[model samples]
Target: MESRPSVARPFYSTFADLYDHVVTDPVGPWTEAVEGALASRGVERGTLLDAGCGTGRHAAAFAALGHRVTLLDASAELLAVASTRCPGAPAHLGDVRDPHLPGSFDVLTCRGVLNDLLGDADRDAAVRSSARLLRPGGMLALDVRDVGRSRERTDDTPRSTTVHRDTGSAVTFTHRSRWEDGLLVVAEEHRERSPDGSVDVQEFTFRMRPWTEQEVHERLGRAGFADVVTGPGVGGRWDRLFVTAVRRA
Candidate 1:
């Protein structure tokens, strides 16, 4: 499969609205890793930019922690959702690989965005661009998966859950994910039933490339980041590869 930059935005646009509900959580494993990494680097509060900020989960968390947060994503629908998450934060509708912002940021976060590129060149461009977006001595915190570990998995993980809010309706979501051709692809079918017998079925597909920690480290180095470190992913073993690096002064 070839890397199609043309389909990246469209692929994300289809399910951008359901991002916060189904994808990332502000207090979830991702937040744990990112927040911990930021804390370790003594980044308690500063200017922060979340590149590819889907629904602004991480951006909102940082903002609540006293950091000035900015959210950026290619899909406008996602940006709209991010607006609700980080109400006053500036949301930019643009690709992270080509971000246009007013000034440099102290911390740049590119989570859950790079692996989707699934191509060496495409992800590299994003990495280089991320370094450029940061000020000297600023840090880039990003994550990827272990493609080799995912490749060995033979069965699809099936998950079913129903979530209910304080009022309105209930949403039952079924998730099915499998690995194909070095890509971890997932399909989510959501069935929402309203009170008045109204039912809506929404389907969303997502794919990410499981990248080794070494590849991520090298990419960061190529982007002029020094003292790169590949920390453990969200879970133990070769699960989530969280890479943190600082722009060389």
Candidate 2:
């Protein structure tokens, strides 16, 4: 058994390569839902920012649908993968909490990002930064885990999935989550088995705070957003709340 050093790498650094293996959701449904939300506001196609874009799957999907896409992520490794996936689309390395990008967009999508922020100040900063990055009347779509639904679904049981790489190696990923003070603390372990019978393991732990639809709306509204609308599981997960709001003109 080989254990990785305890030194911390950037969040998602080790997970970047294994992202697609763990998150196997097709980009089709995500793009469709985002487009549907933006289209309701008379936005067919325009500059779109995929904030916290992991591996650029959704950005690529949106670009294929004729929308100019930009990708931003804090993890350099993940941003590189996203850049490769969308060669023409500009990619930036920044945090949504205070993205300093110069361009404004007609639409923005932040999926599975806000929940990573554990503090009210950080969450509000992210929301306000998102508004600042959009042009007036631009649409913003995001999703967060529904706190109640997530708690009901979480059993605190460990689940594992294995992926076979073409290099004659296999990686097994396991995770267990528990509720703590309105936060879901997840502990993850990734074990890699080589064809030569050697094994290595890497472990990570993180916390997520799911939001109620009303709380999300209040955050957006406080950040100068208007016309907020929310739905359940637009991204194909019943435990998530999908929300859309427009930057007040």
Worst 10 residues of 1 by lDDT: 1-10
The digit string of per-residue lDDT tens for model 2 on 133-184 reads 9999999989789999999888889999998877788889888999988899
Give the least accurate 10-residue stretch of model 2, judged by summed lDDT. 3-12
Candidate 1 has what TM-score? 0.80
Off by over 4 Å in 1: 1-19, 23-44, 152-154, 164-170, 193-204, 235-238
Candidate 2 local lDDT, residue 115: 89
Residue pairs clashing, model 2:
none
Give the C-alpha miss distance for residue 69 in model 2, angstroms.
0.6
| Tens-digit lDDT track of model 1 for 36-107 | 777787655588898988777778877887889999987888888889989989889887766776788898
Q: Which RMSD values do the candidates have, in order?
A: 5.1, 1.6
lDDT top scorer: 2
Off by over 4 Å in 2: 4-11
